[model samples]
Target: MNTGNSPLAAGRARLGALSLAITGVLFLLYPLVRPYADEKSMQGAEAMASPAWVAAHLFGAVGFIFLALGLLGLRIALRETAAEPLASRAVVVTWIGAGLTLLYFGAEDFSLNAIGQRAVNEQNLKLLVELTEAVRYNPAAITVFGAGLVLLAVGVILAAVAVWRSGLLPRWSGVPLALGFALFIPQFFGTPAMRIAHGLLITAGSLWLASSLWRAQRR
Candidate 1:
C-alpha cells in the first residue's frame, strides 16, 4: 500500500506538488514582467524602459524558469507509462508550447513596453506620434505581435488539456488556461476594451497556475 514510492505515482505527485510552487513564483513575479501601458490607451503596452518594469521582467523570467521545470516534471509523469501514445504526445506538445510561449511572451513584454514608452511620455500622451504612423506603415511590429499571439494560443490549448488530464495538479488550473485561451481573441479584435478584458483574464490564469504550482510544492 506504499504508493508514495512508485515512480509513476511519485512523478505524478511530484508534478502536482511542483506545479503549485512554480505557479506561485510566476504569480508573484508576473506584475514585474508584464507590460505596462497608459491607462488611457489600453491600446497595448509592454514592461520595458521603466526600471521597475525591468526588475519585474527579470524576476518574472526567473519564475518562468521554474514553471518550465514543473512542466518538464509533468512531461515525465505522462511519458509512455500508459499504453497510449496520444496522451504522452499531448503532454510533450503542451510542455514545448508553454515554454515557447513563455519565452516569446517575455520578449514581447519588454519590447512592447519599450515601444510604448517611446511613443508616450510622462504626460501620458503620445510622445512620438510619428512613430505610431511609422508602426502603421511598417509591418514588423504587427508581425511580431501575431507570432506571439499564435504561440500563446497553441500553448494555452495544449497546456490546459494536459493539466486537466495529468491529475498532477488541481483541475482548477485548467480554468486559467481556458480563460487565457479565450482572451486571445480580443487581442486580435483590435479593441482597447477587449485588450483590457483579455489582460484581466490572462492575469487571473497566471496567478491561478502560480498558486497551483506553489501548493503542489508544499505537499
Candidate 2:
C-alpha cells in the first residue's frame, strides 16, 4: 500500500488549508464593509460610494476565490484520505456549490460595483438604486443566485455531516460547519444582525476546517 503522501496530495492539503484560513479571516472582516441599508437609497448610495464599501466588495471577491480554491483542495484531500463514498460525494457537491456562489459573487463585486460607482459619480442616485434592485431581484438573476445560495448551504451541511461520519477530522468541527450555514436561514429576514451572525458562524466553521486540515497536513 502507498502510505506516503504524494507531492500533489501534500500540496493540495497545504494550499487548501491556507486558502480556507484566508477565506475565514476575510469573512470576519466582511461585516465592517457590509452596508446597513438599501444599496439604492440615498443613504445606501452614499455608503457604497465610500472607500470602505469598495474595499469590502474587493475583499469579498478575493475571499470567494479563496473559498472556491479551498473547496477544490478539500475535495482532493478527502479523496486522498480514502473517505467513504458519501463523503466524497458531499465534497463534490460542496465544490459545485462553491463554484456557483463564486460566479454570483464575482458579478456582484465587479460588474455591479462598477455600475453603482459610476452612478454615484454621475450623481444619479435613482439609477444606482434601480440598478441595485434590478440586479438583486431580476427574475433570472434571482433564480440562479437563489439556487446557488441553496446549493451552498445544503452542500456545507452535507459535507459537515459526511466529515463527522468519516472521521476525517475532529468530529466536533462538523457541528459548527453544519450549524454555521443553518444560521443563514434567518438572514432572509433582511436584518443586519442576522446577516452578521450568519457570516460569523460561517467564518467560525471555515476556521475550524482550516485548522483541522493544517494539523492533518503537518502530521
Candidate 3:
C-alpha cells in the first residue's frame, strides 16, 4: 500500500477521533465533578484540600493532552487539503499551549493540594489565603498560564477556521469547540450552571468534529 494509504493513517484517524471524544468528555467532567468552594475563605479550605479538587484539575490537564494528540492526528488527516496549513499551525499552537498550561495545572494539582491539606490540618485560614495568593499571583507563573490559555484559544480558533475551509468536513464542526475555548477564561467568573453548560458545548463540538473526521476517513 502507498504510505499515505497505510494502516498508520487509519490508526491515526481513529486515535484522533477517540482522543477528541475523550477530551470533550474529560473537559466536561472536570468542572462537573470538582469540589467548589471559595478558595479565599476559611469555610472553603476543606473543599480545596479534598481529593476531588486535585482530580478536577487533573481532568483538564489530561484533556489538554488528548487535545494535543488529537490535533497531531488531525494534521495528518488534513494532509494535502486546503486546510492543511491552518491545521499545521493549530497543531503547533495547541502543543505549546498544552505544555505551558500543564505547568500551571501541575502546580494547581499538587501545590494547592498540599497547601489546602496543610491549612486544614493546622486550622490556618489566613495562611491558606496568603499562600494561595502568593502562588496564584506569582508574576511569571500567572503570565505564562494566561498566555497558555490565550494560545489554546487561538489554536482552537485556527482549527475551527481550518475545518470551515476543508471541503472534506462539515464547516461548522469546529465551532462549538472553538467557542468553548474562547470562553474558557471568562467561564471561571460565571455560575456553576454556566460552567457546566460550557462543558456541554465542548462536548458537542468534539462530537461534531470527530464524526465528520471519522466519516471523511471512511470515505
lDDT digits (tens) for residues 112-192 of candidate 1: 456667644553435434444454334664555455445545545555666666555576775665565555646645454
Candidate numbers, best lDDT first, in rank order: 3, 2, 1
Top TM-score hit = 3
Residue-level lDDT of model 3, residues 83-142, one tens digit each, is 889999999999998899899889888898899989999999999999888888899999
Expressed as tens digits, the lDDT of each residue in 66-121 for candidate 2 is 76677666666566444545555665666676666667676666666666677867
Clashes of each: 14, 1, 0
Candidate 1 — number of clashing residue pairs?
14
Using lDDT as the yardstick, the better of models 2 and 3 is 3
Q: Between candidates 1 and 2, which one is better according to lDDT?
A: 2
TM-scores of the candidates in the order shown? 0.54, 0.81, 0.95
lDDT of each: 0.51, 0.68, 0.86
TM-score for candidate 3, residues paired by index:
0.95
